[model samples]
Target: MAKKSKQYEYDLSEVKRLIGETDKNYREIAAETGCPYASVVYHGRKIRGRVNRMRQEELNIEEQQPVLSITEETTETPKMLSGGTALSISRSDVHIHDAEQEAAKMIKAARALGLNKVNITIDR
Candidate 1:
């Protein structure tokens, strides 16, 4: 069995500062900080959200504009399931309380289906 790697710790302040000062990509930041690329992306989003919220608060806007809006013509494509017979998932269908639970549910469902590996494609 393979050992799971530990998650890297990062200072929120530093993350905020770097995001504000530079337009570097998440992968670059991750490489420089020795953290996972996902972590870098997550932290960058968090920092951006906080900053945006602060700006909104300062502006005292009664209502905020929607970031995205769905129209009548918009169509959502059905998700496709593909791959092997032990259990691998590219995308997931189950809805759970958290991402961890969702992932577990996907794994369990794949096992139950006798799928060795599976790939899920979401057409949007």
Candidate 2:
């Protein structure tokens, strides 16, 4: 007589492993793992929620730092560009230019840290 093969049920371990491996949605995980859609949805929420919580905690810690830590003052006054620039800038214009430069530096730092487009989604 021939013996029949047994089917295995989806478990938490499999779901957690898939969650850690891919950033796919619950539906996608269900299709990929051959598990039930409801099961993936249920467990995937827990996994994603944990990750989002950790991210929030880290952000909270970073927010405690002082905003205006730089206290250095420039001794020299603003001067015109050495290349004979056509645009003449006033004192207020120099302040605005300094603000723009600071913003640019912040953007460069964010991109360097791989946070150019951080999307913290915990749902489908």
| TM-score for each of the candidates | 0.32, 0.31
TM-score of 2: 0.31
Off by over 4 Å in 1: 7-12, 49-124
Lowest summed lDDT across 10 adjacent residues in model 1 is found at 65-74
Per-residue error (Å), model 2, residue 81: 62
Q: What would you estimate as the lDDT of candidate 1?
A: 0.53
Q: Write the per-residue lDDT of candidate 1 for residues 36-118, one digit (tens) a residue.
A: 77766777777665344356575455234322221112133323345422333443332222445555666688677754554
lDDT by residue (1-124, candidate 2, tens digit) is 8999656466668777988677676777777777788677677677776444457577677556533221222244423244643222222222322555654554565465544332111111
**For candidate 2, what is the lDDT?**
0.53
Q: Show pairs that collide, candidate 1.
A: 82-119, 84-116, 84-117, 85-115, 85-116, 86-115, 86-116, 87-116
Each candidate's lDDT (Cα)?
Answer: 0.53, 0.53
